[model samples]
Structure formats: C-alpha cells, structure tokens
Target: MSDIYDLITKRMDLLTREKEVFADNILRSSVPGEREKVIKFKNLVTHGGATPKAQATGLKSTNKNHLSLSTHLGSTRMTTKKTDSDVSLSGNTINAEDQLRKINDATTKYYEMTSLYQSYMRRHNTVITGR
Candidate 1:
C-alpha cells in the first residue's frame, strides 16, 4: 500500500510542479499554457479515480442552463452582459456569478476553491512524507 502511495505521490509531485508552472503561465497571460495546465491538472486529479461526476455520464446532459433574467435597454438590448474577470482565479470559466461575485461579497466560491486546493496539497504532502 505504501509503495502504491509512493508511486502516486511521485506522479502527484510532478503534477503539482506542473500546476505551479501552469499557474505562472496563466498569470503571465499565456492562453495556450493555461489550457495545457487545465488538461494536465484534470488528468492528475482524475488519475485512477473511482467515481465519475454526473456530467461525465455516457448519456446526454440533463442539466439545463439558467437563462438570464436581466432586462433590456432601448436598441442595445442589454442581453449581452460582460464583466471583467480580474477577481476570479486564473483559468476559471466565466459566468454571471463570476462578475457578481467580484462586484459583491462572493466568498463561497473563493473559499471553496481555497479549501479544495489546501486539502489537495495536504493529502499529497501527507502521502509523500508519511507523517
């Protein structure tokens, strides 16, 4: 079991380093690198994973996209709402909450992402160090 953990940890360590590099590339506004990082991180997270997310099911997606209730202007028809994504972490897909979260106190998403990252690092470290 420890040997398996060790092997996993080696791969995870490499993934972590890759993640850091990808993060730096994203920070520097490198789109291709950011995309590559997303793919690499996804592979690392899902490597030998047991369960599949709901969206990953073989059938068609059952989830429905929530439509915007936003009002329209004169001729402009304010349907196209765009906002700056400066507040969101690098590589996150943009959405309504991304903007509102930036405009308002959107702590849950940030907190959740932080907690997840911390947990990932903690587990990875524990597996590697065995302490």
Candidate 2:
C-alpha cells in the first residue's frame, strides 16, 4: 500500500525517532544540578541577615599597650633574598606518549562514526529528503 513518498516519510519517522531517543536519554540522565544551584544561590542571598556595616581602618581591642599589639608590630619585618642574575624555568609539558595516544584514539573514533553515518545516508538515499 505504501508508495515511494510514503516510504520516504516512514524513513523520516525512523530518523526522527532515533533523534528523540538520544534527546530523551540526555534529559533523563541529567542530574538535578540546576535545582541544586538555584537552592544554593537562594540560601547565599538570604543568609546575610541584618549585619551592620563595618568601618574602614578598624583596630582590634583599641589598646596600643596590649602585649599582643607589640608582638604583632615586631612580626612585621622585611627580609632580603638573593636576586636571580639569570632567569630559568621549566614549564609543565604534556607527556608526548599520552598526547599521541589520545590523538590516535580520537581520530579512530571520529572516522568510525563518520563512516557509519555516511553508510546510513547512502543506503537510505532514496528515502532521505536531500541527496
């Protein structure tokens, strides 16, 4: 009972179904990260309740004769270190072996997926809308 146009529409439905399945899986698998983020931000916004503004140049205890103040003043000492005459640095470099392995793995997967999709399109050319 199905003619060429009906077959084409049917094949389109197949592609549409596959697309929907992939989309539904992604949606169902997504964790409640958005809800968690909204709750965290709301808590942060509401947590700062009725705090008076602090003045600049604030001093603790306001007692200069305090033993703690003397100790704090004595602790603020400057130190001199040897200046480097020549600059030398070793930057973090990627391991060549690992880099090559990843490149090879990604290239193989890309080609495999590309070939599969190409084959599918070719086999279903008559049913596909655009050549």
lDDT of 1 by residue, 1-131 (tens): 45654544544444444344434433544342122222333433543331233224432323445322220110111121234444246553333333333423324444454565667778889989997
Give Cα-based local distance difference scores for all models. 0.38, 0.35
TM-score of 2: 0.28
Task: Put down candidate 2 lDDT per residue, 20-131, tens digits, no spaces.
Answer: 3334333432333211000122322332321112112232445756543222222222222233322124322223343345445545655565565566667688566564
In TM-score terms, which candidate is top? 2
Write out the backbone clash pairs for model 2: none
Relative to the true structure, candidate 1 reaches a TM of: 0.24
